[model samples]
Target: MRTPARRTAAALAALLLCLAAAPATHAASPHRHRAATLDDLARQHGRYFGSAVDNPELADTAYSDLLGSEFGQTTPGNGMKWDATEPRRGVFDFTAGDEIVNYAHAKGLKVRGHTLLWHSQLPNWLTSGTWTADELRAILKSHITQVVKHNRGKVFAWDVANEIMNEDGTYRQSIFYKTLGPGYVADALRWARAADPNVKLYLNDYNVEGLGAKSDAYYALIKQLKAEGVPVDGFGMQAHLALQHGFPNDVRGNIRRFADLGVDVAVTELDIRMILPADETELAQQADWYGKMTSACLAVRRCVGITLWGYSDGHSWIPSTFPGEGAALPWDENLGHKPAYDAIRNALTAARS
Candidate 1:
């Protein structure tokens, strides 16, 4: 294919693809004339717009109904995590995860499995036990295989491993990391792939939405994983923005760099949080930031989607997590559209033109 004769053929094919990719940016469906939802607008540009949901929020019919209608996909905030899935060794509980997956399906929303492995919120059994490397590896493998196989066709993607790196570009010393060494990340991905060959496996993390030590570490690791024929499908940038930290530097460029590594990039777990009692000015700034983040994802071909941590501030975890900060979503506590919501909509809608 690299021969001189094939070069011209390849160029022609590239041109044809470019032509096909443009001109009709939006998807054509029967409901095209109706007011575009965020998901509908994103679908036009070949991407999904989603939000994360917790099981307790499902009990709030008003919230759940709106969530089901507005978004194209959902990630269970805590439902699919290791703590919730496997409480005891070889004992699995899927009640929480099943509820969300079933709800998403019933509402015509796709599910991105929150995570198969993470450093935090792990069950006591896993953390409290002292096991040999062989024992721990077996434990991890069984958990991933069972979880992925159980939800095989239900989820489109998995955060196969989450928050595996520290801020200084070093691997986080999680139980898996401590027991199985750095190879654990790749192993988890392989196990997930073996169980659910069709689901996209990803490395999900926060603080990687921009060019920094943290994002750089992922860039290198993903490049190495691909070079070694690992089954990584995407990189999840938990775009948990804070107004105090300023917008991530050259986010479109950051997304592009990961795309170059032959892995799709996603704005997974996006939220723009602000100080308590947000005002008109802070709200407007947050809106602009949201618009920029949306536009950045739309610009990258391999950037598959964006998923908010939660849709409304009413259910946000910011207040509890960060003492003085709250109001981190596009929707207010009363399910009212904040300025950020319209900004996101405008960006997604503009992508079609």
Candidate 2:
């Protein structure tokens, strides 16, 4: 037998817990009108500010909740990659990619396909087996065609080829390059175009933000491709910077140079990593750098947008990938805004004004 007062207190406790467990429904909040999200500010300047995400991350309601509210576009981190989309040579799977596409559509956001061809994360059947030039070309065409065709209307763009250049600016000797020769790039691009002419095709790479040998290699390749009438629409500079190495030199100039070649440029995977145990001083520096990177993109006419590798440090790939190096995003593990967040906001706000 419980007292009425005790029973009321017990009921209240259960209600509080239920509310805590439920995800934030900002639509019903009285305060949804006041705040300006990154995407909103970006659109004012005629660009899209986005983040990369995967299927598993959707399980974290808080993460997904923020993503839906803040981003206007999303890149499927690994769901649309070769490994996930076509594990078997002839067989195909769209389960992972479709989940992300459906999520983005539900949230009223656009989707960018990560990659149709890459040197890594390839299915074993494709990588392990040896092939003649003709044999390899058919497989490559089939893969790109099926993937692009499957997501034709859903994905607005595709990273048609990813990380295909060496640090010294040489073409990476991927299986495609070895078996089908340099023409493989043109062939793959053509196949993707045939599959979906409307989808924008891009060649994405890291360490190309600055004027360096790696970027130079891409410059020459794109020029040649354009001269030959190849369908190269964009160049993706993956701004995966580490504070320890210092920011890339002449980032804006590099973007402009590529843009002059008649292709849109984007900061595809933007993240600035710092050494562990970040102090106030280091964080402040990180914050300033974030603002500078955002400003760089705004300065260039053909620089289309910036997509953070991931928005929260909690979901960032830095810790495990770099070991001792983390804290590489605008938000911390708890989804709290870090100094970098304010810096990015200020940069975009200034542009709007």
Candidate 3:
């Protein structure tokens, strides 16, 4: 019997042969004539279409133009993270994040702060030094307050505490969790709310797009927070999908459960990846998944938006992290639209109708 990876490779090779004999045509032909931009179609259905961008990508003129034209919202991929904002303890910097916010304003795009608190990518000062519980709690409060205050009017939403739970519904034993316990989640949300009363505060995570142990944990936590009148406003599903793993089952149902908690839902950081050297079959499957994800979000009234991790394959983070697996975004390396782009547009158009 072939190993899973070997099986995947064999399947991919077979698909390539079939695609080589196929005629050229629009990948998502039925919806190609809908000239409306994603943002335009999304607006008709009381939603927004968005993409995440990093600071360095701004230097590319072509990338910038497409970002400005194609999406109505943008999230700074790393600019607002703890390490980026406060490289040194007690010293805060918003220069990088500010650039993205300013660009968003110029383009008439809404901004979603990538994150305010997370376990990874923390500064050396905080992670290296030992701190008493009191000291760590004070430091955490100050960071959230200062960062959120600085971006108050600029960012409309924030991932207040990200990836706080493991796949088995247990909390990750991060420094914050080790120090402050699970109460830190609620405290972080409270601090953010105090800093920016108008901004929507969200708990974001990957692998929680479907009904599973991880998502169930969030459901319980969200319910508890709501009962306590905490200012939690949303849950962000970072739908980073892989073709071999299959799409999340009942994604609409999962999103609806969160919406039932009286908090909005969003497809944050969505990217569908397949093994490299993608062929027509893999691309078609990817396009179908994109449409399904968009349709899932649209099925729920409180699902506010969908944000691609990045809009194009050229600058995606997948190849570096996953190795040998990429071609994840809606655009190819040359800034040209892929089949997934039309699939998303088609879904949005159908939602409007």
TM-scores of the candidates are 0.90, 0.91, 0.90
* Model 2 clashing residue pairs (backbone): none
The TM-score of predicted model 1 comes to 0.90
Q: Write the per-residue lDDT of candidate 3 for residues 1-353, one digit (tens) a residue.
A: 75799889999999999999898787798677756789888988999999999999999889988899889999999999989999999999999999999999999999999898899999999999899999999999999999999998998999999999999999999999999999999999999999989999999999999999999999999999999998899999999999999889789999999999999999999999999889999999999999999999999999999999999999999999999999999999999989999999889887777
Q: What is the C-alpha RMSD of each candidate to the true structure, in Å?
A: 14.5, 8.8, 17.1
Provide the global lDDT of candidate 3 against the true structure: 0.94
TM-score of candidate 3 on Cα atoms, chains taken together: 0.90
Local distance difference test scores for all models: 0.94, 0.92, 0.94
* Tens-digit lDDT track of model 1 for 1-353: 35697888999999999998886655766467767789989999999999999999999999999999899999999998888999888899999999999999999999999889988989999899999999999999999999999999999999999999999999998888888999998999899989988999999999888899999999999999999999999999999999999998689999999999889999999999999789999999999999999999999999999999999999999999999999999999999999999999999878888
Off by over 4 Å in 2: 1-32
**Model 1: residue 249 alpha-carbon error in angstroms:** 2.6
Candidate 1: where are CA atoms >4 Å away?
1-33
Ranked candidates (TM-score, high to low) = 2, 1, 3
Worst 10 residues of 3 by lDDT: 27-36
Q: What is the lDDT of residue 155 in candidate 2?
A: 90
Q: Identify the leading candidate in terms of TM-score.
A: 2
lDDT of 2 at 99: 96
Candidate 1: how large is its RMSD? Answer: 14.5
